[model samples]
Every structure is written in structure tokens, then in C-alpha cells.
Target: MPRFGSWLLAVCFFVSGGAFAGTTCPNFFIAGSAPTLDASLLSRTTEVCHTEYVLFASGVTKGPLYSAEHLTAAQIAGANSISRSGSWHQETGIPTADRSQSSDYTNSGYDRGHMTPAGDASTLTSEGETFSMANVVPQLHKLNAGEWEKIENYVRNIATQQGEVYVVTGPAFDPTTIPTIGKDNVAVPAYTWKAVYEPGVGAAAFLCTNADNYTCAVVSVDDVKTMSGVDPFPALSATMKSNPIGLTLP
Candidate 1:
């Protein structure tokens, strides 16, 4: 894994509106291979690593395209022992013009939703890092607190039962038009999805619309890739992507 200090330095040199392809943070990806984003998302997007997760932050959307984690049962136990630290803040490593500020979400009627939920962090520091603006998106209050929250907990329960799992959570936007909130133009995604891969089992995803009357569905990993323009498990077999085991929704 690359040193966090070096990653911070690398982020400092990012040119505004430039594409950051070939960006990789292996520690947070499944099989040490990072997800590939569509060419259109490359510009103004860079990989940002945290203690418990890694995300590709998009300057255009002023939020993460996705946040990923290799979660273990032991880590979940550790996380359960720690209290949440609600210290939401902007990522200073990213250029000010390219990142969202906490103030931007103020009174925006949207919640600063976390792609990597705080409940997944195993320490106070990790939990705090999950609150970074780069790891957040503008989500409807009902969705964030309702179905989305259920999905997060469900993922954690699987990690506990299966010993470990690779999880990816992100927002999906429409190509033609994307709604926005706040001064930074943080994207209000039409949909948000969470995908999980268990080593001995199969891979599946939960797709949810970001609305007051939100509905969620169990889908294949390939379905997530097609919609979000990101293939989270590139190393997996075609069968794994094609046939997903049904994960019961809470």
C-alpha cells in the first residue's frame, strides 16, 4: 500500500479540471485492484484514501464517485466498540475550488450522506475521516435516514456473518442532467447503490433511488457497473458479475 503521506502530497499537485486516471489505492480495493471509471468521469476526479476506506472524489460533482472498503468481522467488532465522532469537515488535501465545504450543505434540504458510513469505521479517527466532504453526497433526508440506512446495516451484518466482505457504495447520475445543491454544486444523485462481494459466496448490489418515496432492489454487480459507469470488481469472473445471489433486504 502507498503511504498516506505520499498520497496527500500527490493530491496537492492535482490541476483543476484535469483527469486523474491510473490512480490506485490497492489497500481499499478488492484483490488490490481499483475500480475503473468511465472516461467521462476521469476529468476532475482523483483517488482519495482514508484510514478505513478509499474513494474517488469528483471535482465536477464535488463529491465521491464511490467509497470502497475491505471489511472484516474483527474490524466490525472494533467498530461497534467505538462511539461515532460527528466531526464533518472538508478535505484540505483536495484543492479548495475542487472540494465541497461543510458550509455548502447548510440548509440545503439535503443530508451530507456518507458513501462510507461512519458505522463501518473501527476507530475514532477512521470514523472522523468518513465525514470528509469528499466522501459525501447530497442525499434526500428520507432516503438517507430510511432505506439507505437499512442497506448500510445489512452490509455490516453480512461482514459479521461471512467473516469478511468487499463493499462499494456510490451515487449514480444521469448523463444528460444532474441536479445539484450548495455553492460547490455537490450532486444530488438520482440513485445511490451499494455492492458487496463475499469471497466464497457471490456478489450482489442494492440499488436505491434517492427520493422521499425511495425504493431499493437487489441487483447484479454488472448492473451496478453499467449504471454507475464504474466496475467495482474487475478481477471477478463473468459468472460472478452475471449471476448475483439474492441478499435479503431488511
Candidate 2:
């Protein structure tokens, strides 16, 4: 809890080679700080065995603390071609009722949206791992399929073009506003937040509110931190953030 979350990083991440450039899960270089974790929050880190990132699940929201990843150009180029594993399932120990499952949204009108999108995974194994229920949240269908998905693609494209990118993203909610979807009580977030970081280029974010037209606006990382309560990249303030193309999407 020394700022961004060095303790959680040590506890949750285990060093690995290759695309990660020798780092563990819950990478903090992108955030410029490790979250100051709260024991009372009862959050726990669970490695999504199928992908290269990690999940920090919230006991209250019963959703991802935020899913994180480091993506390289080579991986991004191949990520689009891989098919989804369709392997959504619950984590061990967490009560099934507090967890989100694929079945929970069968007819619930929301999308079983991925916090760490399948398209962000570079390999078949990693791509498939993204399907784990730990990486999902009950997202608004249009937001999930359109704006949110567009953000994912845009991040990957930029990362590939400018070396590698580190990202952390997830949903936002109000304690009194959880719209529980299934019998399991998987919560629907009021907003979805995403932060992206490139070492030299700096950090940026998006706040996609759950709505009819979910086109999100490019935001300051500080704005995302204030709203999400998770600072993925602390150094990314409005003045330092950049949108090279100045483009907005549907």
C-alpha cells in the first residue's frame, strides 16, 4: 500500500520471461504507482491462467479489481487472428453466488464483456484464458460491443506502433447501485474505465458510462483514478496525456 500497490504486486505477480520483458502480473510501470490497497476491501489477486495478465477481484463488487497486461507489437499482430476459448468459469474459493458466470447473462440483456479482451491476448492459450469469468463484468451490450471494443482495438494498435503498452481496465459502480444480474448477483457497473501507458509517450484513459450510446471520451488518467479509485498510471495527468490522432469513435 505504498502508493500504487507494490505489496499487491509482490504478492500477486511472479516473474516471467518474453513479452512481459521480465515482470510479473499486475504490472505497475504503466501506472507510475501501485495502488494503496485496503485490507478491509477483501480484494484478492487471481492469475487468469489463460492469459498474460492478472485479476484483482473485489469482494464487494465481486468483479475484477482491474485486469492488466503488457502487449508487444508481435503479439498485437497475431492477437486478432486467434479465436476465443469460450471458457468462462468461476474462481476457486469465492462463493459461486458472489461470482459472475456466463450463465448469469444468458438472457439478462447485458453482455459478458471482457475486462481483458480476448483480442488483447497474443497467443491461443492467452486469448482463450481471457474467457475466464474473472475477466468479465456485466457490460451494456452496445458499450461492450461497440465503444469498449473499439478502445481495446485502438490500444492494441497504438501499442504495436509505439513499441509495447501496459494497460489496466475494469468497471465502476456505486455501492447502492449494483444492478445484480443473475441469482449469483453479478453486479452491473455504472461506468467502465480503462488506462493505457506507453513508457515514453505517457498515459491516457476513457470513462464509458453504461448507456444507450456508449461512445467514450478520451480522459485524463487522473480523472479515471478519481472515478475508479484505482490508479493504474499515476503520472498520467491531463497535461501529460495525449491523443495523437485526436480521433473519436462510434
Strongest candidate by lDDT: 1
lDDT tens string, model 2, 1-250?
2232421232322112111111244343554344432233434333342357766676556678677777788788787677766577676535554566777788998888888888877788777677777788888788887878888888888878887987878776654446887766777877787777776766667667777765466665655544555556544554654332233443
Candidate 2 positional error at 240, Å: 4.3
* Candidate 2 ranges with C-alpha deviation above 4 Å: 1-33, 37-51, 93-98, 235-250
Model 2 scores what on Cα lDDT? 0.64
TM-score of 2: 0.77
Question: Which TM-score value belongs to model 1?
Answer: 0.90
Candidate 1 minimal-lDDT segment of 10 residues: 7-16
Candidate 1, residues 189-236, lDDT tens digits: the string is 877889899988989888787888887888787777767777778778
Best by TM-score: 1
- List per-prediction Cα lDDT, in the order shown: 0.81, 0.64
Residue 211's lDDT in candidate 1: 82
